[model samples]
Target: MADHRAALRAVVTQRMLTDPAHDLAHLDRVWLIAQTIADQRTNQRVLLAACYLHDLINLPKDDPNRHLASQQSATESEPILAELGFAASEICNTQHAIAAHSYSANIPPESPEACILRDADRLDALGAIGIARTFAVSGALGRALYDIADPFAEDRVLDDQKFAIDHWKTKLLNLPAEMVTDGGRDLAHKRVTQMLGFLEIFSEEIGHPLPINWKSV
Candidate 1:
């Protein structure tokens, strides 16, 4: 196989790519998460490749075209993967994992590696680190911390574009339910609890007694 890792690192560094929340460090974390969740049925190399290369075409959270980023990545990855000397099956497996890992893509993971990579990526989007990332992206976009009138989004249309807090209700809070693996689900539940605790603290800071009803709305 060709030296994809070396080639990718060179590309990332040479481009001076820097998204505070989705940079190489984030890839490292997701790779670790995948490694931690890897099973006998999973192809380790394919899964790891997907983890590192999935965000090769990352879109900003507020981008109107963000949902298309995954498939776009999959389409864009072929030449790079081919040049890396990936076998046909490996390239297919890696592309599927990358394509389906996006929450917005809503593509059903079709293989063990696909499911594992999906769970792994979502796991990275929960808990303390997830909080930091949410705010970092939000801040970069000039999004308000919360809606001053309805911080917890109890009585208004949730708009993560305008307020980062709405993301908790809109996406992050439901991630544990979406986890693809038993272990990933368990960890998601734990991380979501920490997120809930943080929400409680946020409510106190805002002096709002809003309660979370993620199941209904």
Candidate 2:
């Protein structure tokens, strides 16, 4: 397993896109989280492979073909899996997990491994790490921290594409409800609590304290 992990890391390091929010470190964290919440029946090997390669074909968030990235990654991983000595069944399962892990992919996770992979990956989009990632990606995309006039979108529709903070209300804060596993949900709630705390301080520091209703999960 150590050798396989090293091999996967090498492959990822060689091929990962130059996105701060989706680097090798992100993949490492996702794999770690998946292991932590995985059930006894979960296949660690498949989960590990999927976690490392799920973003194999990384696409810009605003790309019209963003929803297809996961499926493309799944296809791209086939030859790599074969080279890594994966069995036919293992390769199939691994590809399915990778293809279904994306939020935009809209593919249902049919196996426990796929569910865990999805939950773990989404978990990365919450808590302190999640906050950092949100800002990092937003900065990369040339978005503002928040709308100055109505930071909480009080007067306008939420638009994460233009404002980083709007993403919390639009998606990040809502992730707990979408978690597939009980463990993932529990962890997501804890992470969201931290995010809410950050939002309160952020609002106050900017002289635009959020509405009381916007502070909780």
The 10-residue segment with the lowest total lDDT in model 1: 8-17
Please report the candidate that would top TM-score against the real structure: 2
What does the lDDT read for residue 59 in candidate 2? 97
* Candidate 1 regions with alpha-carbon error over 4 angstroms: 1-7, 212-217
For model 2, the local distance difference test gives: 0.93
lDDT of model 2, residue 200:
82
Number of the predicted model whose lDDT against the real structure is largest: 2
Question: What are the runs in model 2 whose C-alpha is more than 4 Å off?
Answer: none
How does each model score on TM-score?
0.90, 0.98
Q: List model 2 lDDT by residue over 64-150, tens digit each.
A: 999999999999999998999999999999999999999998999999999999999999999999999999999999999999999
Note the clash tally of each candidate: 0, 0
Worst 10 residues of 2 by lDDT: 208-217
For residues 91-172, could you state the per-residue lDDT of candidate 1 as single tens digits? 9988999899998888999998888889988888888999999999889999999988888777788998899989888889
